[model samples]
Target: MFRRTFWFTSGVAAGVWATTKVNRKLKQLTPENLAVTAANKAIEAGHRLKDRAVGFALDVRDNMVQREAELGDALGLNAPVADRALPPPRRYAAIENRTGPEHVEGPAHQKNPYNRNEDH
Candidate 1:
């Protein structure tokens, strides 16, 4: 009778342990928990991306500062390049014709205006 009682108690304990473990797993895998985890990861990735972009900009600025004179000479900038503010974005007028405003209606060949059939 003692052996049967021991076996029964052990079976009950095993069942309880399994129930607790399954409940814990189910709680962890709930939709709310998963969404929260995903959101946290996304926020972390965004922060990392911003950090990398800032670092890249700093590196570019450093390289430009080191090669300021060479770059200025190549680009024909006589004054201090870093001090100069960037020019405002160019505003383009609306195209009113099929040829557009940029298309110059002039002689096809500027070199030889009289030669109409000149290879332009």
Candidate 2:
């Protein structure tokens, strides 16, 4: 009789444990919980991708600066001011600054040929 009672108690305990475990699992699988988990994972992935893109951009900028320096050295673009070549003196036409008002047809605002409205 003691053996049968012990077995029965053991069976009841096992069933209770199983039911509790299943209930916790079901709660975790609910829609709200699942959506929160998915959103968290998506945000984590976006952060990782942004970090990778920023790293790649930094590397490209570093390489670009290095290449520009190399080219500047190859060409004498980085030479001292005294060593640099100068363009020949140019003879420019003298600019006339007249004091009189600029000649315009009708009112200055009305001279806007781009205006499509005749009412203006």
Candidate 3:
């Protein structure tokens, strides 16, 4: 009968499909193939992690620069280009000569005894 023939064909097709799927799965589960698959997956994950870390670092650097700009503006360091007056030269107390009578460096430790230049 036509009905019996159709069912027989369908059953055979299903069995063949199932067998092919199982064979493919078994092949993938074999030691060498499984190791390769795992390694490939690990490489993919590492790439994704590296991309995320790079993005995070870039974001942090941008934020840091932006914050520094904000602080400079708040502290009035961002002077306009037109107001270009040179600041008065600064005099550091330590750098000034103190050999004058007002500030004598009379000697206990004036010249370090440990100085190899003087020793030589």
lDDT of each: 0.82, 0.84, 0.85
Candidate 3 global Cα RMSD: 6.7
TM-score of every model versus the real structure: 0.45, 0.59, 0.68
The predicted structure with the larger TM-score, 1 or 2, is 2
Ranking of candidates on lDDT, top first: 3, 2, 1
Q: How many residue pairs clash in each candidate?
A: 0, 0, 0
Of 2 and 3, the candidate ahead on lDDT is 3
Please identify model 2 stretches exceeding 4 Å from their true place.
1-16, 90-120
The root-mean-square deviation over C-alpha atoms between each candidate and the true structure, in angstroms, is: 14.0, 11.1, 6.7
The positional error of residue 18 in candidate 1, measured at the CA in angstroms, is: 4.0
lDDT of 1 at 92: 62
Q: Using TM-score, rank the candidates from best to worst.
A: 3, 2, 1
Give the CA lDDT, 0 to 100, for residue 51 in model 1.
100
Better of 1 and 3 by lDDT: 3
Q: Write the per-residue lDDT of candidate 3 for residues 31-92, one digit (tens) a residue.
A: 99999999999999999999999999999999999999999899877979787588899986
Best by lDDT: 3
Write model 1 residue lDDT over 1-120, tens digit each, in one string.
Answer: 999999999999999999999999999899999999899999999999999999999999999887997887788786777877899999865434545433555676233345333444
